[model samples]
Target: MLALPASADEARRSGYDFMSRATRAMQDEDAANTGMLWVKDGEALWNGKAGGANRACADCHGDAVASMKGVATRYPAFDARMRRPVSLEQRINLCRTEKQKATPLAHEGPDLLALSAYIGMQSRGMPIAIVMDENTKPFLEAGRETFNRRQGQLNLSCAQCHEDNWGRKLAGNPITQAHPTGYPLYRLEWQGVGSLQRRLRNCLVGTRTQAYAYGAPEFVDLELFLMWRANGMTLETPAVRP
Candidate 1:
């Protein structure tokens, strides 16, 4: 059994810490990281002209290296128009429909994953830094409730495993504290890149629960809670997981 970290301050470990040395090495080296392939694809899409606007993300954002730095850390952010929090994926789709006059990318589709991974990469190593305000407080509370609520035939809440039983093994895999730092990552099990929602769906299915449809508000609320829980952790876009 893995030993728990000693205190609340020490409790928040990145999922990377639970990885085997070889997996950690894989995530460390870009050349070996399969997720970089999606990042490359995303870069191409970022520069390619899209939609009726005939504009690339570059047209408005300029050099992503500069413009997108630290941006991912603030997401699951409040959207004034929607009067609720929106995930980065939703934000991207909104830009597609509103600014680019393009149809939204399919949820969990390669193009969407590629673009998200690309944007997430720009903020690599930055701490998660979501701000809480009056407008976002209610949503945050809802997220917290979701994290703690028991559901499914197995009667499991996210906190049961991630918060209470972390540092333990489940089916030979170490159960680390749930964190949202390395989203749109590469999973060896999937043989490709995937979003956090995809992983969450897998968990819900494992627990014999009905998973939410992609882009559901419930998923976004849960994501907000996870990101807030992982506040101050470094971003590791395109992280490798086994």
Candidate 2:
């Protein structure tokens, strides 16, 4: 285990850094990473037609490998239409409604996870590079407040573990700095691909706090902050984790 640092930003590392070698190996090799199953599904979905427009994501985006490279790393980006920051998942839904003319995929569902994982894969090895500006500043501050605010019966804040005492063990699990570089990742506990929102909800529940509904603005705000916090970290879509 790495030594705990006093400062939250002092020794920033991916959750990947805290994993056991065996678990890391699972993530390192696509053949061993079960999350690839979702990536495969996403590839198919990307090419499949949908909705009134009968358009596939490929229709507009073209080859994802070229079009989507470094894209995920720059989200949650400011959306001028919404006047707030939108997550990558939210952007996908926007394209569906406005471009593809399809009903949005269910949150945390296989199709959403698959498509998100697929796009995220295109940015693999790229550094996170969220852009902040006047429009996104308020949301970023909101996210920062959420991270520091105490919640639930435990009266614990996210900073307590992730910021103040990362690298320490909690219930035999290492406490990692809460970075959002990898999403639509595979968690052993879930036994399937899941989104960062799912993980956030889990943490909220674990802290005995009320979890916001899926697609909540609060969740997106927090995601924006996390992406900013993890800026410069490598993208690791479909990452395997214990």
Candidate 3:
């Protein structure tokens, strides 16, 4: 019987805390422990001197100290060249093709997931930093609209479960506002770590939005909305969840 407030961000953060606690009770340390495997794989990929160019990620980035830090905190960001929103998966592929001169990994492939987990893990403890500069504001506004708009057979918007009824359990799980701060999460319910786009697609399916492509702009916009909403939460990449 709870209702969301005027500020959607506030409602999401408040609701997610309660929902996360509930989820912890339902699921255990599977995500937190198993999630590290992806990070380890990422370390290998980053250090491996593969490809014709003979360049490992460390060759250019050099140990993932500064470049890696705060990298994930700004993901699902707006792409100026594409003139649209882009997910971390898309960005990874682009970097692989453009910089690494290697084939892009599949959306849910191990390389992408590992790299995403590694990057996300680097930003641990960093507060999400979603900038709504002029270039990104339109996407931000669009995301808000998408989140609030009613759709699906049930005619339920994301706000309904995440904001309005966050403390209430649905299908044995408390509905959280769906924050992206700990993206590339490893959910015990899922049995593995998954990118935020993966998580967003899950929500769209749950809401019956026909589920956009893995890295579609719709998902990117939604990611932005969620991250922006969770602006102050600490990053918990590869975090445990039910």
Candidate 4:
């Protein structure tokens, strides 16, 4: 059997400080992160013409630097047309199909991730500010339930590790408060950048739970909850993690 920390406070203090030490130094620096390669690709895609309309994102949105600033922090927002909450990835696809007359990129595909990364980079260092009004409450509640409900062969809930034992060591890994700040991140394990949904799927699998398909409602709801949980945390797009 593995030794456990006596308390959550002790675990938080003594566990390996991955955020500060193990992760690449200045991980979030655009010049340092390998993930920025995708962002560069996305910039090219934004300017280049595409699809039936022969319109680039720049055609409608103008310069992303000016139009997209701080836009990512408010995402996984409610989309009235879809009648659901949509992740930044989903929203990008929606625009591509509906407005740009372009084919929607596959979930977790290179181009999609690149575009999402590019957009997310604009919001780096901005605080997450997803609004939770009456309209959004139902989705938020569903996310809360998902976070708290135990599942999988291990029967663990997200709260068990992230809330109850945060800062503790699990299989020699220090568990931090699961924040969504550093997304579209370059993980040492993946050797490439990945989205929050990818990370969430890994967590679900770690507990031996059934992972939801990409773009599933459950994933969006969970993401919304996480954004709400990490409310006010600064964005760290393209961040490096061990």
Specify the poorest-scoring 10-residue window by lDDT in model 4.
Answer: 8-17
On the 0 to 100 scale, the lDDT of residue 179 in model 1 is: 93
Error of 1 at 216 (Å): 0.7
Ranking by TM-score: 1, 2, 4, 3
lDDT for residue 39 in candidate 4, whole number 0-100: 89
Any idea what lDDT model 1 has? 0.90
lDDT of 1 by residue, 52-162 (tens): 998888999998889989888988999999999999999999988988888999999999999999999999999888888888878888988988999899999999999
CA lDDT, candidate 3, residue 43:
83
**Per-residue lDDT of candidate 3, residues 1-242 (tens digit):** 12224575454453225545555543235443677788889888888875656668788888775789987877777788988767777887877777778887898888889988887778988987776677887888788888898887678888887767876789887666667667676777688888777776677787777777777677778788877777767787767666
Worst 10 residues of 2 by lDDT: 1-10
Candidate 4: TM-score?
A: 0.91
Cα shift from native, residue 167, model 3 (Å): 0.9
> What residue pairs clash in candidate 2, if any at all?
none
lDDT score, candidate 1, position 102: 88
**lDDT for model 2, on a 0 to 1 scale?**
0.90
TM-score of each: 0.96, 0.95, 0.86, 0.91
- TM-score winner between 2 and 4, please give it: 2
CA lDDT, every prediction?
0.90, 0.90, 0.74, 0.82
